[model samples]
Target chain A: MSEQYVEEGDRRREIIEAALRVFSERGFGGATIKEIAREAGIRSPALIYWYFKDKRALFQEVLGAKVPVVRAVADLARVMDLPPEEALTKLGRAYFAFERMDARVLRLVIGEAIRRPEVAEAFVRAGPGRVLEFLKRYLERQIELGRLRPHDVRSGARMFVGMLIPQLAGKLFFPAMVEDGLTDEEHLRNAVETFLRGLAPES
Target chain B: MSEQYVEEGDRRREIIEAALRVFSERGFGGATIKEIAREAGIRSPALIYWYFKDKRALFQEVLGAKVPVVRAVADLARVMDLPPEEALTKLGRAYFAFERMDARVLRLVIGEAIRRPEVAEAFVRAGPGRVLEFLKRYLERQIELGRLRPHDVRSGARMFVGMLIPQLAGKLFFPAMVEDGLTDEEHLRNAVETFLRGLAPES
Candidate 1:
């Protein structure tokens, strides 16, 4: 392979990564191609133009690139016979870490969903919507196995997500508002335990 | 009293209410004084300018007007002799209702806080900041009374608030994304129950 080809490939990936952050931080209307180029540290937008036709195309590319994070959360659902609490704890940690890894994306999709109609549906399908579905499936399995409490799967999944939101979304996106200094691991443990306790069948 | 005086007073209140919705719908940067005027049904920006110096003043006023919602949460914490779980349940419902009453304000503060540093601190003090502090104090009292599980006041409070965020913040702001058909009352009951169950002391 030619050295130039490798460099070009690296640059494309870098641009996409930068665009993802930029678009997430500033929604489509707020973010410009030039700013994306600037975020990517590319001096010439003509170079970005060479890769993407316009800001919409770049945004679509960025959203498409995020498919893997959703897949990673879905992957967390696939596991062997661990206890229900431990299984949920592990999955909770993975979900929190996945969100913290790219905090801007959640906030971006959430904030701009109103302005950009398509982004909301696209994001939920690629992000929380899938995770909620996976979580319900996991919870149903636990109930069938009698290893966990039976409850409203839909609302229960939302409650678990609710516990995750404070540190994962709140602290990550708005650090000033959240004063808890606990690392992501600590917060996740606390959140997951609380959620499991809530879900535990009356002993 | 003069009719003009009554009309002027109503007009000022109208502008503030309109500005509140507009700011919450559009962040600080996105909302313009003209748009606010339009939102209030005022034909002239000059009419708005007569009431306030600028958009910042209008926003500050709006924030000031939101003190009641925060107080409602604080009041929930003050009831005498309720068990810890019931106290929190009542508070959770109050908090949820408060957020729902004006969903746009919550979204507006959360979104613009990233860009506007001052708004985050001020709004938090007036909104979630006060609620969290009040909640922690209430929980500490409950733990001392041996009615609730021993836990980090901060983390416990975060967990409680976490349970509220999904519906309060998500549904109103991004209606397209959140498809849960549950009414506000149903969602609130589920959240409050899960939160209390999470905090239940060891049997």
Candidate 2:
């Protein structure tokens, strides 16, 4: 019975992965269950229903799956031993790396989130609000340690995230913006360095 | 003949404004010429053709109209008398204020730019490339004047503009993100100050 359950779980994941690609290419309104099923190599759309209750349910599942990445970054802030600057740099690198790997996912999320309040609310709950709270606490600790300037930690965190996104999103939606021969890895590392320099404490 | 030409110009402007609203609300593929005509107070769809060759032509005009704002900001860097920091601050404030006043127009430009290379190319030519070039020169001057840290000026400019966009775009697409009770002017001023602080020379 356990083996059967594991196999079913894998099948569900496969379906969700196919759905994400279709949904990203053609938005929620533009995509169809038939197309998603075809992409999944399933003969009947009914199989998707067996895995997910409906199209909305499947989309919510795909969105919820992104929570782990945001959570991982937030959890990194609590390690307590690393220097504040080092911790921030590590977090920034990890965040940018994730963005590079999943640029399409982020674009689809942002695009759909604009049209769907429910998606935006889910994203805020899972990602931005939680990440903001984590960063705020981290900055407060650094401020207490006299390691950083006094400012609104929330605003600072928001600015930090904001700085990374335009270039990251630009590469995803406008690959032409990136000059030839530069890999996404190179661009992201460069972006993280620039961001950290701006955020670094004055000597 | 001149009276007839003036009337024709008025009708063209009406069509463009209507296209802006429709495109902003419904997106490029979703918006129809018929709805645009109705919104423009035209009795027949054929009247749209009298002004614009077609729907695509009208869309192109709307995108092109944004060029003036970009040109004005670029001209700021050419004003040799203003100090670098002061000029950058003013340019940032001007860009943000224009976005606030014309959020719908900006959204239409950005949204369509994502889907159309021509729109994106026009934007790069008119805005980002110009802004970055202007900023690169400004930062180079600041470094030479010993006002900023020695760094790649292009990197500095990209960071500055990247940081500003999220909140500017958020103000349009996510008003809830803004603090309650802050007037638009106050919010913009505060944003400018925060950005300026981020750009301060390292001690």
Candidate 3:
């Protein structure tokens, strides 16, 4: 891209980042364009309209960026020919790492997704649903290979995702819980072990 | 208590009901005393202060009242002597019932709890921590009885609770997922069974 194009792209990214912070702090409806512009170090709220159509458009851009992080992990699982247990372990580690790195953005996505039906639908369709589909197919293959038990694919997918949410959310919303020594890497590993054990087939 | 006391108590309950609806709709920071007073069919916001001191106090009262719903379910596990699986099934049913009955309050509590650490702390202390404690003890007992594998209670408890959250959240944020002809009872039973299977000992 040209220098001017690159600069415009940088500005758009900056605005989205600032919007994520403001939206995560004050929520979607509560956040103002002026505050977002101020956070981005811009004088005019109209600049946001130049790059994005409106506040809703800007919100969608921020949300849209979050999908690929999870999607990339799911995509990794597809190309790997690892054992079921190993695949799950790798996926879990990736998920945990993602949460640790981009916790604020994750919270912003989850918070808005829960409160707004449109956001939830968009996220589920674009992100979670795709991940679940991949997991379901993988598990089905494992079941066919006699590596796992026959179970409802959807419920099993849900169970797998559910295993990670508490710790992920704890680390996000209750940092004190982690600071108080309740949610360290050891605890997370142990929880993962228990969850994996639960998924193991009859000996 | 006299008839006058009973009438006053009823009025207090009415006010709380209105406050919950208003708070859930507009959120803690967004909601106003005037709106709550109006919802309660009272002429002035002064009655809200007279009953509960301030908005924070009224919010606390609402939180306090709902804490027992989870606690009572946990207590049920202790008082009833049943097989581990059976007890868990009952617990799952009770949990699902509570979520279904008061989905709005649950959402409000979760959303506000995210914004206000104090609200989250109060909820964790009263409801979530108690449930985790009960589950830990119960699972430990099962381990001692040679019913479950030797496992850390905390990890086991986290997995169990983690399993329920998505379903609870899905019921609220994605009602259309359930509107496709599955009754709430069926969904709850499915989740409980999947979780129980996950927790079962290796055959």
Q: Which numbered prediction scores highest in lDDT against the true structure?
A: 1
All candidates in order of lDDT, best leading: 1, 3, 2
The CA root-mean-square deviation of candidate 3, after full C-alpha superposition on the true structure, stands at 5.6
Candidate 2 chain A, run of 10 with poorest lDDT: A175-184
Q: Per-prediction DockQ scores?
A: 0.44, 0.28, 0.32
Better of 1 and 2 by TM-score: 1
lDDT of each: 0.68, 0.61, 0.65
lDDT tens string, model 2, A13-110? 88878987887787665678899999987888988898888777776666545434464554553644466556655665555555332555556555
- Per-prediction tally of clashes: 0, 0, 0
TM-score of predicted chain A against the true chain A, for each candidate: 0.65, 0.60, 0.62
In candidate 1, which residue pairs get closer than 3 Å at backbone N, Cα or C atoms, i.e. clash?
Answer: none
Q: Show where candidate 1 strays beyond 4 Å.
A: A1-71, A98-101, B1-71, B74-77, B98-101
DockQ score of the complex predicted as candidate 2: 0.28
Note the residue pairs that clash in candidate 3.
Answer: none
Error of 3 at A83 (Å): 1.6
- Each prediction's TM-score versus the true structure: 0.72, 0.68, 0.72
lDDT head-to-head 1 vs 2, winner? 1
Per-residue lDDT of candidate 1, residues A1-203 (tens digit): 54245487788888999888787677656787888889888877888998888766676566555644354454553553567667667666666555442556655566666445566565555566766777777777777877668777767777777777666654655564477576667767777777777777767
